[model samples]
Target: MANVSYFEAWGMWFDGRSTPGNDLLGLSMIWWGRFGKILSFVAGAAVIVDLLGPSRLSRYSDRLTGFLARRTFMATAGASFVAAITFLWITDPIGMHRLLQSVLCLTFVTAAGLLVTAVSRALPATHRVIRAASRERVVG
Candidate 1:
């Protein structure tokens, strides 16, 4: 569980050098590759914000546990592990290693997303309970 900047962490983990200009395959890759870069850049920017902008790891952890709960974590973790393993000893792997790394990087995003959802589920219930406990003002 190493904490890292979104871009650096994901980029290294899945160092698939993207060749943006290679139209060898067809038109499909060009569109996909461009968007992939956009997504990667945005994710990296978000990671930087999460780290450098007055946010704490403890805060992030709470969010992770609550939102990222059992199901989402398990699902993403499973995907990540499977993707990571797919890179092993593959020949002419179609740059699949990088793709797998990208997939693994998404697992963390899934974790964070789950954490957020968990928090949303908790706040409403807690808020309702608190509201119910409040009494009418009885000014003497």
Candidate 2:
């Protein structure tokens, strides 16, 4: 018989629901889902470590710490936002579907804004190089 969709199975597993099925695909889904959780835990731990200050083992710890320290608020806010979304999504909170949808939209917009900001910051140096190269070609 047909089984639940992969994503559905993943969601079910995440929220402590029953397993997908007793088939190979269900086993695969469970394995990947558990792997995803492991990855998420590692990422969360990394963020916590970065927030708590740099490690002594890394050579570039000072520079990494400096960057993270400068944007601590932003980093914490973004992490909290992600955690909240994950919790709500898994818990299946009452009447939160619309909120989750809105949050998803906001996330896309925030990602776009960050992308634009990064591009804008890099453009000035790029433009200067292009201008200088063109001038050199024209003169030489």
Who wins the TM-score comparison?
Answer: 2
Runs in model 1 deviating more than 4 A are: 1-100, 136-140
Candidate 2 C-alpha lDDT tens digits along 1-140: 33566576667769997664423354554565688799999999988856654233232443445565566557655655665566557546555576766776567556655654564455555555555655675577
Tens digits of per-residue lDDT for model 1 on 36-86?
899999999889855653324334544545554555656555554554454
Name the TM-score of candidate 1. 0.25
Off by over 4 Å in 2: 1-96
Per-residue error for 36 in candidate 2, Å, reads 35
Error of 1 at 85 (Å): 23
In model 1, state the lDDT of residue 19: 39
Ten residues in a row with the worst lDDT in model 1?
131-140
